[model samples]
Target: MTTKSLSIPLDFPFPSPKAHPLLTLHSKIQFPCKFPLFSLPQRIQFLRNQCPPKCQNPNDNNNPVPYTSQQEAHFTETQEAISQFLQEFGISAAESNSIALNSPKYAKMLFDSVKDLEEWTSWKSGGDGNEFATLGFKEKVAYMAKEKGDNGKVAFLESLGLSLSSSMNVARYLHGESLPNLIHKVKYMKEILFSDSDDKRLVGKYARCMMMNLSIPIDEDLQQTLSLFEKVEARRGGLDMLGSSEVTFRCLVESFPRILLLPLDLHLKPMVEFLDSVGVPKEHMREIFLLFPPVIICDITGINRKVQALKKVWAFDKDFGKMLLKYPWILSTAIQKNYKEIVSFFHMEKVDKSSVDTAIRSWPHILGCSTSKLEVMVEQLAKLGIRNKKLGQVISKSPQLLLRKPQEFLQVVLFLEDLGFDRETVGQVASRCPEIFAASIEKTLKKKIEFLDRIGVSKDHLPRVIKKYPELLVSDVNRTILPRMKYLKDVGLSKKDIAFMVRRFSPLLGYSIEEVLRPKYEFLVNTMKKPVEDVVGYPRYFSYSLEKKIMPRFWVLKGRNIECSLKDMLAKNDEEFAADFMGF
Candidate 1:
């Protein structure tokens, strides 16, 4: 018990045997224990091993560690803050993971900052990196940063490793509510995504979403934006991006049909016409065409059909035909939609299957009535013995017959035959009958041939007529009329003889005395240089003013300029000077 203590060596290799047993036990427990020390792994193994045994006892209430109030408060506060932030930014917290999350300004900020963390964590967790896959850690971080009210800070994070998230947010801005801001933002993102090869998926997704969200009736600015995207895609071969996005592709496909239907923009006019001419495949056209308002479709088709029907009837009507042709599409549309209107156009009282048949049978004989009436005539012809083919031949042979009264001419022919006349005799009798010829024939003949020196009927056709109807005109005045007129005029017959000749021959020549005399007077005025106004006794001097001044001035102004020498320009030729001045 004496203080015979010894100092232990600092570097002692082993414990002293002389040490107290209790001390030895303590030492063994503290440092020199030989059994395997319980490591974290071993502790986990022990816990796992004891779990089954502990679980078997049942009734052991091992409630999950209850959350502390502080922790709970923290979580609650965080959630509340997030809710308020979303509301402040006009976004829905319920749409947290939706694309809509990127649309709002606040949502974009959050998405940019927190999306990265989410993306990284997602990637670490074995996400496939597909756009549809869960976001990674980086994405989550970006989203969180955005939510924490640090949009500018989130943008800085994007520079680090969250470029895709940033680009996606920008694209959302473009498509979502902040379209104006998004437009500018998209330009920057477009450069980043397109410049880098690794972020193509993100770029594609952004482009697709932007296209989908664009308004249908785009303005010039938006159109330019679209054009830019199109150019980029074309140059970069990234159209697959648009194609992959269902929303975007569907919008584009719908555009053609919309344009075809309404054509709001005049720019689409030529395109529509071209499509019509080339004709979209029936199957494809039908699919899109069906989307048009029914009334619009009816109107377009009706107009086209009316035009075609009018052309068919009026092709031989010359001036009338030309007028109808000018509005072919309109006429066709009327005919297609309203058969009654088309028939009425020709002055037909009613249009039915019979009317249509008659119209077709009449072929080239639609000149007399309005187009609608002509259609009825054709219908009637079809009902008669005339087949379409025979009718066509007849129409071609005697196109002039369309101008005649159908019943009157038919009666004349029949009457001549009943009077023991042959076909030639019937033709002659029909030609002589006033009602069998068009009322305008005299005026038309006078206008067509200005002067006629000889006034005798041709022996060629006349002999045939005389041989068939020798009893009709037994008087020699019908044969020697021209010579008799000359003799009468020479022997003091004066204007009376000339008038008599005109009246006698008017029916034969298909003209009136007045029509023939007017041209003769015009010819005399032209040859003598006496003003037509003076000779014809026009009291207003209107004719004199028109002929001597207005007409000459008009001719000078309207006529084409001769590429003559300067001599002509300086000469008395007022016409040349006027033409030169007008650049004619």
Candidate 2:
């Protein structure tokens, strides 16, 4: 089919609702360009204002959509604007008011898109008596999505399993973005994300998130991003896709506003290849994009330089790849600069570059954190003997501490001190399990403490127990701690038995039930002929390596016909046991 070129008259009037009637020349302003050049907000505002003062074809039975004040700026104006436009379109006052009140935001979009279609159709058809007047709102937008002025978009929308009104709603979004970009974006999405799926609505959902991102320019802004989205083939050679699910794809698009606007070959494809080369699995691509949106827009060469810098100084083994996956922004130029600044700060503090490098790799998100924030956290740590080389060591072991606000880290320190941990002991806990500083004051740390206390761990014992195993605070009380407590109860240890054992050895509760506790308890009851009560007295019974220590010692005792308490059998050093128990 031959393409019909749009022929707008030289005197074509562009709508300008914001202009006052006395300064009416602006309303009649001619557009030498094809599509209108105004921004989305202006377009919506213009539509709001375009509601005629008196509709030429008004239906009088119902009141027009009410104009009411809202906390949102210009919300009343938006409602007033929409009421008149809907009335001008011959909608009843009741319907107009319902639409205007329900969600004036979408009403604005619908009005803007429908009006754009009306104006463009008049231009294309040379003032014909509104060929679009007989059509519904969705049909008008589907017509706007024409490929070469044909039935391209109308057919595509029909295939999406949406209602006629819903199709029109999607078309409103599609209409806002230029047709060509919409095509390329949908095509790109289909190739990358939904190639294997037959569900057409999946494509529609992703297109809505990606095609008309508020951050990207549509017709008014420069339109010269290379059309790399076109002719892009699907992944080959069983490539790991960034992700396959609709949720991940939607999140990735929402995370990065300009993702659909980017050209495929020049931006995304190369970045995908780079990530794959660096050992980032395709399944993790969504995470990389979501965490560092600029990664796709950034020059791949710069990213390569950052990766090379990391490998040259440190390394990009599986762990470094894992670091990049965790904090993909580490490849951002700004983050790289921040990384350098942090290294320099640490150097001036007499912390070696290697230590800082280790710290960054261990917690790469620190690269994205502001240097001022890091310094603030540093000062906080200084109060706890965590400065200079010791600071670097603490950071290397638990670099996520840098992400904590100084106030938050101090809150954890204060809480620990209130629990009777001395400042020195608190410092030790900070070094041992720094993430406790980052856990929620209410959700995680407090919840675990309360769970322990409710289960009969005494106030006097909390300090020693928590200080010995600060990680217990970080473990999930329901998933990790409670289940283990339940397992002990099931194995003939009472809740009190478990609580007393935990007071002596808090880390005892953290062990895997199936891996450590289950086998030891079973053997203690079934094979060792020791009562399950034996473990309640010496919960360190779980900590010993079954094959390496416990079994070897127990078999020696069994052979020697020795009978002893759990403490006497397990707590003695092997040399002491052999000397004392075996008579060596």
Candidate 3:
């Protein structure tokens, strides 16, 4: 559809109102009251002296009459001047404010307005609107995006599932980005404005922040850089991030605006590909980018050196990929300044060299921290009655323990005290499972306790249950614990039996029903012809690998006419089972 064009008309005429009776020039020129006619310039000056535009004449006495020849000449000259001014600018008298024509500012405004109109007319005559300029900002953007062959980006923005106002707001926002062709750049930036999926106000906020922060006429090479960033986001589920109800994506750009200016192929691509090669899963790339956007932008040699230090120098035997996924900010830490001292400190503290990566994976933020800060954290843990080798074990198990400030740690201690645990018990619990320190005691821990209490574990028994299975305090009641217990109940275990099972085998809550319970129980009920009581009595049956150990032994025992129970088949190690049960 053809859009209407906007333009200024060249032939727009000024309208003239009815002239003053005495000021009107008749066919025969005659002066009123037989006054002698002055020269034209003098006549104009006499008219100005009679009545200025904004004020009354000072020459007149308090009582004034209209028919004096001087007044008549003055009024006539003033009318001629008004008529000439309107004809000069071609402005209609009806449209023109009489007060406006008398001021110097109005003359300047007329000059500028006329100049702009002339230029616009000339351009229109030569180039006609071409349909582009006539389009609204949004349609213009879509046309430009399509012209650049960026249908994917157009589709990407359209798929945001936003309202019409929100979509137009985004279009307007991206147009204001000052991109040469906004289509390519808009894809990378979609997340920043729409981070809160349903909030339209952020669109305005994002524009303001960009106008304040980003230098403009954005550099040309930055487009390619931003394109690479968009490729990364696209790979990492940009829509899902944009769909987030929280400010996850907005926080990413705010934290790392420099990511858009880095060299993509030379620096960013290689670094990201290197991380991917080494085991950084695509899922975790967003986290890595948000946390350490410089991972790709920093000196490639430096990033490589830091990575090598972790892999070769520190000897991270645990899966480096999983470690990177866990501790993405570790990539931002300096290799030369921080890597050695931190590794050595952990090593000196009795954390095994290979397990250093595991420790780092658990609490990646420690790699960014100072050795002295870590040492202080250790000393604080020591004051809590967890010192020396015990403190090292805690750090190794839960590296995030080092990240907690001294006061936050004290709060956890105080919170645990309120929960009826003594200092010694807290120390013991922390030593065994340092991850408990990371759990939200008020929410996660409290909910777990409430769930346990609802399920028949008494207040007196709470400490014992938690001490035995501390992970239960942080486990999702709906996702893990309840689902597994519901499966047990569906199979005929009563609530009392299930509660007894939880007390007897609290670790069973950690195993998956799909992977562990169903297969083992199927074997016990269907294969062994055993009752549900067998599984209830021995919950350890769920922990064994079905193919590797459990099934192989069960079939061999059945072939040999041996009546081996689930515990007997799984309890023995290879050599012990061969010697004792298999007749080796």
In terms of lDDT, the best-performing candidate is: 2
The per-prediction tally of clashing pairs is: 62, 3, 5
Candidate 3, lDDT over the whole model: 0.54
Off by over 4 Å in 1: 1-261, 266-268, 271-394, 397-426, 429-493, 503-584
Q: Write the per-residue lDDT of candidate 1 for residues 35-98, one digit (tens) a residue.
A: 1335534432332222222123334347433434443333323333344433344444453222
**In candidate 2, where is summed lDDT lowest over 10 consecutive residues?**
224-233
Please give the ranking of all candidate structures by lDDT, highest first, separated by commas. Answer: 2, 3, 1
| Per-model lDDT | 0.34, 0.59, 0.54
TM-score of 1: 0.20
Tens digits of per-residue lDDT for model 3, 1-584: 12233342435331111221223323232222111255645544443433332223434456444445653443443333333333233434542223222222212222223233343444564444333345433232222223323222212232233222222334433432322233233343443223333543433332232223222222323333344335334534442343342333333333344444444456555766777777776545544454334564577777767678767755564487776655444454342345567778877777665565556666555555667777877777777688656766777788777767777777777877877788888888888777878777677677777888899887777777777777888788888888989999999899988887777777888888888888888887898888998777777787788889888988888888898666777888899989977789
TM-score of each: 0.20, 0.60, 0.49
Tens-place lDDT per residue, model 2, 115-179, is 65566665575364354566644344333333212222222332322222333434544443443
Q: Which window of 10 residues has the lowest lDDT sum in candidate 3? A: 13-22
Give me the overall lDDT of model 1: 0.34
Point out the higher-scoring one by lDDT: 1 or 2. 2
